[model samples]
Target: MSMRLARPGTSDKAETSPLAVRGLTVSYGGDPVVFSVDMTVAPGQMTAIVGPNGAGKSTLLKACLGIVKPLAGRITAWGKPVARQSSRIAYVPQRTSIDWDFPVTVIDVVLMGMYRDLGLLRRVRPQHREAAMACLDRVGMRDFADRQIGQLSGGQQQRVFLARALAQQADLFLLDEPFAGVDAATESAIIAVLKALRDEGRTIVAVHHDLSTVEAYFDRVFLINRRRIAEGPVSTAFTTDTLHEAYGGRLSDGFTARRA
Candidate 1:
């Protein structure tokens, strides 16, 4: 059996890609972070946003989610404006960006993903708890459901956030470096979950830093460096030349450096 997203609005029948950004530009303070980038992300596939440091990969994801106000261009989902379709999207941010000392338990963090559906005055039901626990089990963290987030390891914490995204129950998932600092086993679990979502026709857009695992994980690659390099299948777009150009002189990872 496959999972399906619950949509509340539509301007067009659900097609291949619901996430599209044209002429996107994001700036902070005075400087531009993402410069006029256009992207069309297709559903039912895992797309990896690969770039070097300061390349604004995270900013691009945020802009599409309407978290950062775009300085230019428009973002759309299902051929309508993003605001109308935001409820169908889920986002998982980097673990390092969060405060580890927060007093929330693992289940508490996962349940936050249901807030959009729960709204301000609603209360959690037994079904929601069951769903959240199922998500935790998918990421191999069900046993630690009651553990405080601050007490978990880096990999465990990352898995918890991913479980939170699953609880969002959205069609499109935007993940920021789910592989960073995770153990190999945790990485495998995350990839398996992402693939399961993709198999169910969900779209996954992730910011990935590991060059070695890119080919194994993503179905398509969007290589960027504040602008655009190339976007295609892993076999073509992730070539030596394109990677070198996008990374420039900053290829520090052992596998990536060897390729260079």
Candidate 2:
């Protein structure tokens, strides 16, 4: 099933805000994993969430998308609570979670993105097909749309998932570890597509590793380690002091090149 793209609104009105979080907290089996946190994601920005492993970067993304319930505080998307605005939010989880044995085609998986708008019973229309193809083209995966997802390389699979997110036509995107385990070229392609989306007035938040690429890739950075140690433009937030705070007193692995 597929959904038709909503018509673009008038340019006069300001673009809608993307996401807001207040006093947010998360826990695993009653153990608090993230402390109270506040954040707002503006339209047309690419923000990277970074920290050491188990720093709650993925937890934050999951909390914002309503996949993991917050122990305290509220999350709002486009001024509505996450539960009420699921359709406007798109999520791309880690590729490791995908079942490689599944016999679905790349296009089929990408088409699933529209299922939320199409509901359950409807078939994908020509418009949906066209939109899906366009999204694939944007990610440079149009030629592989018919191939089985399992047959693709790690980078190709990543692009396929990105195409799926594009098909959703969402205003806010939350991508977890999209660059992990992919080749440098695939990483570059994903970053380019994300920048294009940001340029087109969409909001994107990603859980990213590779401290070397943080400044080169993201406009804003949120350093997290169960709490928000710092958040602001990359130039301000990627400092040694903030890195130490976010990485539990160790500044070696988290500092940007300028600080090293």
Candidate 3:
């Protein structure tokens, strides 16, 4: 599903976009990873952040979630600071960023998503467990709720993380490589669930690796290479020129030929 998006540089009414980043600049050590970037994620659309390796795609997502402090720029969700809207946002980090060896049960990891609502003092009520189970069921992982998180296969682990995100019942989802290590079936299932969320009017933004599937899975694409290269609907912004600009010399001749 797609919504009519405002043209880049055009004015949008307050609180209209689920996410808006302006003049974003992030640095680690002395080098900047993301520089002077601007992005606006349309509500109810699945948006992809695409670029070559080491292009700061993950950093951009982290900056949006306030996981990394930006050297410059503003990030807001519905016109409010991201820090103030933490509960309304659900984040799924890269599987590689997680400690799969951590000793946590599948259900326990999912229950953690409810901490914002459950608070530090409240007990884990039965209704909360039921809701968590429903989220697991949605991701086809209810049967593995009692299993150790470290024991699951990569795809299963990704599904469990998605379940954790779903448990938030959030309005804007920021996922980092949700399909990186998953099998084809798992990828299909995850995309289906994400599309379902978009159908429900939730906004989804992800750091995506598969260029071939960008047009298929996302309504809008933001091409980046340590900076804002291009961003808009897939049909308009995801062109051969933009891909070349973002991926640089990394893309194969055959790939460019195919895109051409």
Candidate 4:
């Protein structure tokens, strides 16, 4: 849990952070959702992007993945532009954003992660299928490999999507609301898998909503509210004062009562 939170480009080591954003700004039509935010994610640890609803946590994550263009800023993974490092990055978006009715089976969705390595012809060989199955097994979904995606419960679907990301074997994992709408058991299972990955020296940046679990689940925390609020180890940064600054009136009495 003892991790450093370096600013972007402050030193040679900082420049090599798993993910770095400098002066990022984004808007939909009129006003900006995120404005002039700077962030640095340390490698080999799980970092949570914590903020109130509609506070642009997801937008910031999307910008890192190049799913949305920034108004002004630079985003890099491993000291290079994200576009140049796509193969080393894997993203798992919010489950609510997916179309559960899609006709693809569990294994089919998992294999999609291998498309990058399959080349232009996109052939699915036996070895690729075996790899995909292994990924499903990692998330305890191998028994549902042949089932339609829509038939599974919300937690099951989340597990399958995570399996897809696992199949990619990327060094950095970006997830949006990973524990959203999931049961306690599923949440525990997912966190266990993510922790195992962090133990393997992989980096994880997740848009986490649960304040109670923030200190327990993440090594670091980035508190954001339209801009950078605080960034450091959860033990130091996940404080009542900082949480209030990021969540303001949205945060309940239970959080305000907790000690830093």
TM-score of each predicted structure versus truth: 0.90, 0.89, 0.95, 0.95
Against the unseen true structure, what C-alpha lDDT does each candidate score? Answer: 0.85, 0.83, 0.90, 0.90
lDDT of 2 by residue, 58-147 (tens): 899998888888889877777777888888888999999889779999989889999986788898898888888999999889999889
Judge candidate 4 against the unseen true structure and give its global Cα lDDT, from 0 to 1.
0.90
- Candidate 2 differs from the real structure by a C-alpha RMSD in angstroms, to one decimal, of 8.2
Relative to the true structure, candidate 2 reaches a TM of 0.89
Candidates 1 and 2 compared: the better one by lDDT is 1
- Candidate 3 is scored at a TM of 0.95
Model 1 off-target regions past 4 Å?
1-16, 252-260
Estimate, for each residue in 1-260, the C-alpha lDDT of model 4 and write its tens digit. Answer: 02223444484554789899988999987788998888889999999999999889999999999999989998888889999999999999999998999899999999899878987797899999999999999899999999999999999999999999999999999999999998888899899999999999999999999998998899999988887888989988888878878887888987678653
Cα RMSD, model 1? 7.0
* RMSD of each predicted structure: 7.0, 8.2, 3.7, 3.3
Candidate 3 lDDT over 1-260, as tens digits, reads 02222336543632578899988999997799998888989899999999999999999999999899999999889999899999999999999988888988999999999999889899999999999999999999999999998999899999999999999999999999999989998999999999999999999999999988998999999988987888889998898888888877898878879988
Clashing pairs in 3: none
lDDT of 1 by residue, 27-116 (tens): 997788898787778677889999998899999998988889988987888777888887898899888899989888999899999998
